[model samples]
Target: MRFSPVTQLSTRFDSVASDIAERLPDTTAGGPALAAGLGIGHVLVAGWNLTREINEFGAEMGPLMAFGLIGGAGLTVCVLAVRLFYSEFDSKQRWLVGWSAVGGATLFGAIVYISILVRLAEGRVIAEPIFVLSLASGMGAVAGVVVGELYATALQSAAVADRQRDQLEFMQSLFRHDVMNSLTVIQSRAEFLTQDTDGQNNRFAETILEYAQNIVGLADRVERMSDVITGRGEIETSPTELRPIVERQVTPLRKSHEEITFDVDVDEVTVVADSLLEEVVGNLVKNAVEHGYDGSDDFTVSVWTTSTGGRTQLHIADTGTGISEELRGEIFERGTSESGSGFGLFFVETMVDHYGGSVRVEANEPSGSVFVVELVTA
Candidate 1:
């Protein structure tokens, strides 16, 4: 898939954010809060020792220092919680509500608990309220910035995936249509040559050509699959005469398989389908010749057309080995074949699906197999 300039930047940014989120420490409610509180408590104890050493009359400083220590610890915990929530959430609204509730709860609980402590320590709670308000305001601003950065990073990642999908489709279409056609020509010519001989030299050449064709067909099938994976190749609509399409494919196939009789029964019915309807008919018909007959002496392939309910149905049936139920589902998938690259029916299916048409295989009455493609009347 081709990626745009912006896509590269977006991917890089996502990678960096993912790394940071994975490696950086998490701020759980209890852990960071408890740790910061302990740190603040230690600082308070150290300050109390320093104050006693500095002055003999410093008893009034005790409650004020204690208030500062606990309030500072609670605010630090609040900041850590905000950072953790922002990293976890990408939506602005989710972070907005989450941080507001969490920060408010922690901040208020700390203030209330500390107020009770100050009241009981023979000290006024007036100074403690000022300290609590300052801590909450500072932490809230830091939380806002963290949440904004996380949301911005998320937006960048979504844009990149979309662009990559487009590029993959374009590449698939170019390979499927253009390259597959060329390989089909080579396969056809090789088959014709293989039929025109009876000696060892001719048979060896034909065998080599047959294998070569199979390989080429396989490569073409892979190309088509690439398009399917990327969602790029789509069937286009065109008015196609069923008779001409069948005749064009039949003429060459008939030349290759002289022993096989083709009971062509198509009328001058036209159907709405892609121009590749010719290839679709060709593959089904060729499949019958190669795999259907099973060495039966009176082997025959038949092509006919019928109309019903404003739809044109084209049928290709063969008095040959029929498809087993086990492999039926995979017949239309690329790289499936009785003796070839298995891409023939897959290409046919792709074209049929594109033009809002349908194709199916069924056991022919009495014996053999029947393949049908139904299209909208042109």
Candidate 2:
């Protein structure tokens, strides 16, 4: 396939940068400070020459214009440094900052470029400025790459450390809570299945499959998390169909939960989300099933979808343990409760927010709670 000129340039730029990086020490072996010292040496020599030129021509011309243009050229790199080095650093970043240095170098190049049009435009020796600028470019590239690569390495190291810490905590949390629960459920269901053999015995089998499904889902999550951390997979989003998401998650639950009736009045609408949308729906439905009814009383859950303005709202109303006004917001936060680990709701809330959606819990008419999830309609 053919590529655009812009694409061609970018590819060329990356290839060149990668090749240069291969030659340089990937570690902080040669300090950028040494290169900076070389740069400083040239600056001092140029300053001395420019000083002599200004003094000799002191009677004829002013150094005001020269100082302004030259000073502006020198200051350009200082300004661009913040933007170029504040994030993750890798060898590729060295090239980016080096390019910025080249941009600053052009201001000096402009002096030479414009001088050809009018030699000694300010009665200064053209050769001296050209020589000085050439030295500056050569030394400046070495300094910029050295400094940027070192700084980028530092930033990248710190970021990697933090990410590793988070990944550790995440895995600990998964095993401590989610994975453990699945195991407990599986053990209990297996024992229960062997002992109970009645018309309702299939319910235990279905619940086992459901728990197995959850265990598989948890594994997928861990794998995806690893991919994101290692820069292998990205969170790509699209207009996900809500109807299928609701059906896929709820269908197995219906088989597992025969006692509780699921009144689904959903629309075939689409929302701005990713593959995680189904997980969000599944977690919420499971939350309702687990905590919806009192042991003695019967309860029902009603799910429906409605759109208004540009937002689509999914309502999961359950006549179960209704959230208190005080606990409404806190329920979604990552924590633990008597009935459940709060990670499921926390994951749901996090994913919904990532998709530019909002989820909130409110009191149902007389009893229980209503979870209203507002999503960007697509």
Candidate 2 is scored at a TM of 0.48
Question: Which one wins on TM-score?
Answer: 2
Q: Residue 93: error of model 1 in Å?
A: 23
Lowest lDDT sum, 10 consecutive residues, model 2, at 28-37
Write candidate 1's Cα lDDT for 1-378 as tens digits: 999999997678556645544554443343233333433443454455445534754557654565455455445545654554445343432333334334444555566667667786876545444334444433443343344345545555655656887676676567567767776776777777778877996788688787777677566556554555446565457787789889988998889888998999898987897556766887888888888977877889999999999898899999887888877777878797667887678777877877788999888866788999988888
Cα lDDT over the full model 1: 0.66
- In model 1, which regions exceed 4 Å deviation? 1-230, 233-235
Residue pairs in clash, model 1: 292-320, 292-321, 336-342, 337-342
How do the residues 161-272 of candidate 2 rate in per-residue lDDT, one tens digit apiece? Answer: 8889778767766765877676777867766775666557766676676677677677777666555444456677799899988988789888988888889989999899
Q: Local distance difference test, per candidate?
A: 0.66, 0.67
TM-score of 1: 0.45
Candidate 2, superposed: residue stretches over 4 Å from native: 1-11, 25-38, 59-61, 64-210, 217-265, 268-276, 283-304, 308-378
